[model samples]
Target: MSSQPTSNAPVLHVQGLGFGFPGHSLFQDWSADFPAGLSLIQGGDGTGKTSLLRLFAGETAPQAGSVTLLGMDAVRQPAEYRAQVFWRDPRAPWPDTLTPLTWVEQLPAHHPRWSGEAWRAHVAGFGLAMHLHKPMYQLSSGSQRKVLLAAALASGAVLTLLDEPLAALDKPSISYLLQALEAEARASRWPGRAVLVAHYDALGDLPWCARIAL
Candidate 1:
């Protein structure tokens, strides 16, 4: 992993964040500042990693507290804040008929920074060139997961939210992904930040990584 220095200003800030289901609390009174660069959030299974990501992505509201992306309150300015973030969940449902290229193009038109070539490159790096033409549902789980990851990285958004990124990949693919992620951060962007939620130990070796144990 390259040893690049990151800035002190937070690209993502969670203050007083709390979330839970009907009876139990997942995380309560939580706070964190994701400084510009890569941050790995590690926790055991059923420890609310996905729930926390959902709250951070604005997919669901937290019971209390707030998230700020690039200093813009995520709850107050969701549309604006979302423009700077890309959240990827491998299990997220998508129509079976959606092709990889079509899905990438479907990203909101408001994000003019999305790069088609970058996406193609990422897919190609994963040996997914042939699979792109196939419907998403026809591909194996690993292929579908790769597409999700490629789309998130290609978004060109400032803050990237990845849940279980290394679940179904071999060493070569994981290395390629790490390289791609690093290149994305070094490239020109509004506020580069990557919040990778994973149980995989290999992610800790990524360049400019900061560990957040929850």
Candidate 2:
């Protein structure tokens, strides 16, 4: 890893990252610096985009190397490292009886900087208020995704990772997401925050601070 930073101070720094499955290698000795702002990780399906996000989330341990967010090392100080990072696999299973409203209500206890106002506003904006009380298993795929969308923006985590956020979203919801992301950048709020989205294409024409190809 280079001791010099070519850009702004990194919110997330990856050095010598190496990982892979049996008989199939994905990344080896990869290093990069992610500064504060929205960054895109673009690649085709099955190209290890989700795998990389999992690595960053500390959900999957890397075979070798380090993932550092803010200043905490994912391997050395997991509890403190994850505290400032928000990453939820959209396809992850939920409790049978869990409701979006209840689940979201508990997020703040885990994420110190979580914003209730942002959550409520996004819930309303995404038309998810009507389904908040319903069981997660009962909600439509699109509705479920909207819940994650709302939470991601409201979390206020220093590092936020969303893999394929647009996967099952509705047209209006997609439009709202684009607008919300753009507004987030324009507001210049959370300059220390780094939002990374894994997608096959750019999110509209929004000005992305960085783009990494997996």
What TM-score do all the candidates reach, one by one? 0.87, 0.94
Residues 1-214 of candidate 2: C-alpha lDDT, one tens digit per residue: 1122234679889999999999999999999888878889999998999999999998888899999986678888888878888898889888999999889889999877788988988998899878988999899888988999899999988889989988989899999998888777665556578888899988789768889987
Which has the greatest lDDT? 2
Error of 2 at 192 (Å): 0.2
TM-score of 1: 0.87
The whole-model lDDT of each prediction reads: 0.75, 0.86
Candidate 1 lDDT, 26-104, residue by residue in tens: 8889998777666778887888888888788878887889998767777788887777767867886779789987887
Residue 186 of model 1 has an lDDT of: 65
Model 1 misplacement above 4 A: 1-7, 108-110, 185-191, 200-204
Per-candidate clashes come to: 0, 0
RMSD of 1: 4.4
